[model samples]
Target: MSKTVGAEGWTVVHQARQKHYDDRYYGQFLGTRKDGRWIVGRMWSGRSMDDGFHDGGWDWSKRFAEPSSTDAADAALKSYVEMSHETFVWNRVFEQRVGEAIDAYWAGPEVPGAPRLSAGWCRTPDGLPGGSTVGLPFHEAKYRLLQYLRSTESTARADLSPRTFNLHDAVELIRQANGPFRFQHGYNAYWLADDAS
Candidate 1:
């Protein structure tokens, strides 16, 4: 049933189809029972049509209960909708944070004594090597670096074979590395480009 509140307070408003007595269904003047008893009936929301009895036939002996105050209903609806909107906002914020962390790690100054390869190895100015056959030894440093790269490009290509460095293998290597910048399951493939950096 539907309820509406006027300027004063809650009141049973009668529509064309049925009269709503505070969430309880009330029959319209027409099609009511032969007896003078006011039968409660169900009606479709926003429609002027009675949906018949609620399981059994209508009952009028029960006292009508007042619907929630209009202010309370409005507040509840507003809170529910706002909560749903906030969930989406938080999800986007989380994704952005992940993206920011990945970007910072990539652009940050190189680690001291980190494995240094020629510019021909990786195309990025970071001087990391990039190749199809460069089987990076299953090591921690390599794992962290791969995780950072994979955050930006999920399907980055690598030359390492499934035997040498499949996706799972690379992820495990990164886990073993266990560095502050490491991720759990990120590395997908190696970057296959001329090391122009």
Candidate 2:
């Protein structure tokens, strides 16, 4: 059987959740009986030994119910597909646009005692680039987003005080904060732009 779709006399029509580390499947299964009855099984593979026996170190279980009619089976499967589509949309929004924005936000360096510009990339009066781009701990986008959410927000501003003004430090600061902020994409960006209008 195909991991994503059906094949070889049966198909995994709709999956409620991905297979667990224990190698158990959770989803809807579709097949045709020799008598032409449509079998739409509620699959909860590896739930228990009674539901299914363990084989080759993998838990396997499924309980099928025949639909009253082909029309009913088709409708039920269609509903599952619709629900899956809705989840796909939200996942895309969170993982793509929101993820990209957050990465862009943290891509900037936030070193202490650095100088910064008013709008564009941070640059020194001598016209040299500033700051270092450090990599986050995890290589995944989701973990980066989590780090961003858990990080403490700093109110440090470029116009702070009459402290010593170093051009090189200012340039470094601007380079550190040169990317789009976390709220600059996804629905947050959209709403912000709408409000600006």
Candidate 3:
């Protein structure tokens, strides 16, 4: 059996208790509501089942037997709806206002009793002067952020900070390491040299 924990801490247990109901390897699952029904199904990639797994596809009939009663279906459907709504809201909020959302979640009245997070500077594995254990090498992080910004929006770089700056450096390093740049966005657009970029 294999298990996975989602970002929200939901535990999904995939046990091979029955061959008929189990695929050779478990893939990601999503709980969703559709046509007034609640369902949990395997996410499939465009490739065949034998291919590597990718998170997508939610065909219900292949995963479970038909509901025994309308009441059961309704209850299941409601659960799926709630879960879907939660996931959607989380992603949307994180994408549009990550800083504000983080501030609200950590400091808001909802967490009145929560302890404050400690702040400090620490050395990296190689003992760089301003390094910390929490992030990747500065170059690597910057490259990844650059790639993300290119794919998403030009203003994405505005949110870059030391703590969240590794992704952009990573993308640039990868490009330089591999060969000449192939990305449509110019290297300067990421503003990698600027601390605030």
Candidate 4:
């Protein structure tokens, strides 16, 4: 059986446990009643928080919009209707609004009683896909280890053949070296050992 709990204009539901899941991961699906429709418009409230997050005054009381589920639903309905009336339901209006909301959320004024998050990131050693590099990087020791491996293992020898090694072997090498490295575990790994099948 399932129950729908309301708050600050939102309907909160206990999401079903995923098959084969192992963690104590719990989440809620927030929905809005628009006209006669139950719209799961808002994103999932993350897979780790509590259902009581709604009742807890320390959550988003200060920063977030209206605090009543019914009111929140009404507001969402207005936003939905407005967004739907302009262009399509999925249009630049909603996109721009979402972007603005995200920007504002990040540039927070720091709610007086809200929980605080403290974190920082360094830069990646080789840069990211788009050629722009930045953000919380691995420990400097990891970079030094990578450099050492590259300098020593990047060479090709007549006796050294990719046909002799496999992705598992490479992973084992990393494990032996006590790595913070994770195998990419994709098509790239399939081609690592030349004849890996």
Q: What is the TM-score of each candidate against the true structure?
A: 0.24, 0.21, 0.20, 0.19
lDDT of 1 by residue, 1-197 (tens): 12322232222222223334344333321111112122122222322235432333332212222232222322322332333232222233433333333223222334565443211123332434444333222232343354444443443444422333544444334434422222222223233222233
In terms of lDDT, model 1 sits at 0.31
- What order do you get sorting by TM-score, best first? 1, 2, 3, 4
Residue-level lDDT of model 2, residues 97-192, one tens digit each, is 332332333333344443221121222334333222233222222223323322211212224432522222332232233332222111111000
**Local accuracy by lDDT, each model:** 0.31, 0.31, 0.30, 0.30
Off by over 4 Å in 2: 1-17, 20-25, 45-73, 79-197
Off by over 4 Å in 1: 1-88, 91-93, 99-147, 157-161, 178-197
Between prediction 2 and prediction 3, which has the larger TM-score? 2
Q: Candidates 3 and 4: which is better by TM-score?
A: 3
Which candidate wins on TM-score?
Answer: 1
Better of 2 and 4 by lDDT: 2
lDDT of 3 by residue, 1-197 (tens): 11333343322222111112333332333222222222343433223343322332232322222442223332443344344333232234333332222122212132233222211122223332322122323334333443344344443343443344343343334333322222222222222222222
* lDDT per residue (tens digit) for residues 88-142 in model 4: 2344555344323322222223334332221111112332221111221222222
lDDT of 3: 0.30
lDDT of 2 at 177: 35
Model 4 Cα displacement at 45 (Å)? 30
